[model samples]
Target: MTLDIVRLLELTGWRAFDVDDRGRVLAGSDESGSMQLVELADGERTDLTALPGAVTGRYLPGERAVVVQHDSDGDERAQLSLLRLDRTGPAELADLEPLVDDPKHVHRLLDVLPGRIVYATNRRNGVDFDVVIRSARSTEEHVLYDGGGLVGEVAVSPDSRYAALTVPAAPALSDQLLLADTMPETRADALRELTDRRAAARHLHLDWLPDASGLIVTSDFGSDRTRIELLEPRSGRRHPLVTSDSCDLSGSLSPDGATLLVQANDDGATRLALHDARTGAHRLDVEPPTDGWCGHPMPAPVWSPDSRFVALSFSGPTAPGDVLLVEAATGRCHPLTFSAAQLTGEDPVEPTAHRIPARDGESIPCFRYAPHEPDSRTAGSAVVIIHGGPESQSVRAFSPIVQALAARGHTVLVPNVRGSTGYGKRWYSADDTRDRLESVADLADLHAWLPTIGVDPDRVALWGGSYGGYMVLAGLAFQSGRWAAGVDIVGISSLESFLRNTAGYRRAHREREYGSLTEDADFLRAASPLNRVSAIAAPLFVIHGANDPRVPLSEAEQVVAAVRDNDLECELHVYQDEGHGLAKRRNRLDAYPKALDFLARHLSG
Candidate 1:
């Protein structure tokens, strides 16, 4: 059965920001260019079109007002607007200008402090973004940090006094963490340079202490093991917190700033441990469920608002993710209730794990999702969803998109291919430089493995965004006959051009991931989908944010032009005010339907 385009779109929860506090609920809805503020109070619902492009809504602690991040046309550009709502209804509190000038670039409100709001803006210029702190009421704006090498993590202290930013240099060199007073130009650089000479050292994780006096940072100091260090921000005095021999250390402090949680592998099984926040003394060890499918315990321990209860999402090799809420003091966990009926209206589909052997006999892990009913005709058409962060992994989770696709009767396989994290440093490092072809080969192998697993080979399609989008085009061009259709969103077509033209902050880190474009010309050209576009056989749907700083719209344009030149079926949809990913609900709603229509027209049998 062909999927109902309209029904599928409806199934997609295109939600905007909604805040409920003190029995009053304010929701942002799509109403032309302006957002409709739906106020629910005393069983009466009143819709007010007060703000434009309302993306998120937050209720201030004491003010009883709602601040929303909104844009005029529901495009990429968004501004924070304060709204005062009471018995007299909703009124505009403040009309604040956007921190960044580029409407197409991505801007995000980092955190709301005592008197100010911190925001970060990423432009096509590079990875290093402009950090701005603005007054909640006045036009007073302060540019804290700019023109730094690609910034990774930015965090503001709970006291609203200190701000920390991590900057990555070369892979072997130590990264710099900058700590500054939230109010002024009192930015002090804390360089965590390695004492030992290493060629590829990089800062992996960073966290600021609650006291705002120090920070805990994890770094790869020319070894497989990650070293954790606690450093005083003002004195620059560093102390070794923990060091492992084989497994990497990954975790952070609890929200209340009382306990530090750490995750490390013990005999191939990931273990979770809690440590004393101040002295780094081992406090508690929580044993995760031992099941064949349960591979390792994730580091994510969701802290409650008060930090008394810790919620966790755990999964293993064969096990689906199970949400558990644990008492912080006792470490006793209880299963949390997640209504699958409300989200998918059915029990969530659990992934079937398989280890697909790579070209060199190296086993690559993958998860396949198909309709629970084997007799269902919607099973044959498959969408091979590639994940972003060629460096990231596809973990077990309640993904709305993946579940929605499965509900529509299509089989989905998410491959952890090459360059994905979670396996080990060696597995991740293998895909670096020119080894991207192996990642491409891994996709073809999965396509070939589909029929053996009772899936239709001919009705297969490819889809992904960001790095995954690049994989979509790669699969089409290299493994041409395998996929029936392809959807590439903000994917790179030309690696060389992408490296040269990408925003500044991102370009600084490109050398470690893809290698320098100047030094590895041949390898980059071979990796580019644009260079091999003549080999494409499948119909293509390319989507991109026109203002994307990472993989610019040029990548999409070049590939679309090349595919059209070859007379291959291709369509390009560019959101003028979007970046890397679609922010507006309307754009997302519009893009997915068009993509579904394209895939159904080509791949559905």
Candidate 2:
């Protein structure tokens, strides 16, 4: 039976929020910014939408409401109001009237302490982050951390004596954490040292010690290894804690700061280890289940509120993801039982792995999800789903989109291709610089290899989002006659244009990956799909978020214009209020139907 897109769209997941320490639930569904607070004791829900703009969220610790002042559709227009949620009622605490009026921007509340709230105002020009210390009693506002370079993960010590700020250089650049005392202008010195050091480290993680005497920083050396170091802010002395050549340690310090838990990969499987904060000694190791591919350890381990048990999402080569809860001290794990009804009603599609030889005779691992029907002889249409990050890998998971497509009598093939991580570091770095063309070749090679695995070659469609979106257009242009239809969502058409208009955080990094726009001008143009738009023959469906910061809306517009100039069968859909990806339930419901219709029209029998 074919899947009903309209009926499935109605079963949307409820917008749920994490319950606070006090058990108060706060969540919003739409862009209207109206936040609803649910009191767990009486099961009573209160609506808080009386503010000027939509309520982004309410802060913790003191239960303060933070609302961004905006017009209809929740567009940022500079004004931000911080209201106090007290027993007396919701009262205005601070009114920030028009800091900088930039359309479709975001003003996020970073931290809220006793008398101040640190926030950041980000526009297209880069994030102008500021530590705004505001008080309701007085009108004094203090600007602490304000400058450039991607600022985030701002943390203030428990005693409020020191503040630690992390500034990410680029996506590829190692992030640096600057620690400073609460005194005025203390962060200025740390920021200057950070600028001068120019740390080329790729991954950096930070956590404050128990007494706030020092900080524990973990930096990944990128060959599937990491080093943990402790830094004393006062003396500037760095102490090396632990170094693992194969295992990647994840998870931060415990809430009580008594112990630090780390998830590491050992012998092609994941194992959780507990470490002593002061001595850096491994105290306990949690052994995962013997079955399945446990080598790919989860990035972060979920610790319980009381720090008694640790929860992790684990999956094997053939099985779907299952949650595992383990005792913190004993390292005993208990797998939670989930029925088909509880997890998913969709039938499981068996995945068969194959090693396809690339252009350079290198074997690229590909996974093919075949239809569950008994009659395998019936040649069915196929969809090639490419994953984003070009650096990320396609793992076994319950994907609603893949299941929906398979239910409609179509085969789905998700290829890891070149540059995808998990296989090895060398395999990932192969697609760097001008090596993106190799990824394009891998797609075409995967298409040719589909027939041996029971998929009809002629009835194939290319589908992807983000970098995958770029691949969709690239496939339609370079291998025009191969696919019947293509779907590109927030993808790039011209690398040159993307380099000029991408988000500030990624501008330098992407230029390094694709090739510097200033130096390799001709090479960037050749790699772009816009230059080869004339070769595209397949029908295309282009979707983009109007306020997308990563790959700007102009990327979609330029591709659609090229398709129109070529007189190709192309349809463009842009959501005005969304950014990067669709966040609203209504937009997602609308997009899936249009996407299915486009693919059915072109590939379905």
Choose the strongest candidate by TM-score.
2
| Deviation from native of the Cα of residue 324 in model 1, angstroms | 10
lDDT of candidate 2 over 64-110, digit per residue (tens): 44333343333333345544444343323233333323455555655
- Candidate 1 ranges with C-alpha deviation above 4 Å: 1-108, 117-147, 156-163, 172-205, 211-213, 218-250, 261-339, 343-347, 374-381, 508-512, 575-578, 600-605
Q: lDDT per prediction?
A: 0.66, 0.63
Candidate no. 2 TM-score: 0.75
Candidate 2: the clashing residue pairs are 33-55, 174-201, 269-294
Q: Local error of candidate 1 at 480, Å?
A: 3.0
Model 2, poorest ten-residue lDDT window? 32-41
Q: What is the C-alpha RMSD of each candidate to the true structure, in Å?
A: 6.3, 5.9
In candidate 2 the C-alpha lDDT for residue 532 amounts to 95
Candidate 1 per-residue lDDT over residues 242-298, each given as its tens digit: 768777776666656777777774423466777777777888876554423334434
Q: What is the lDDT for 579 in model 2?
A: 65
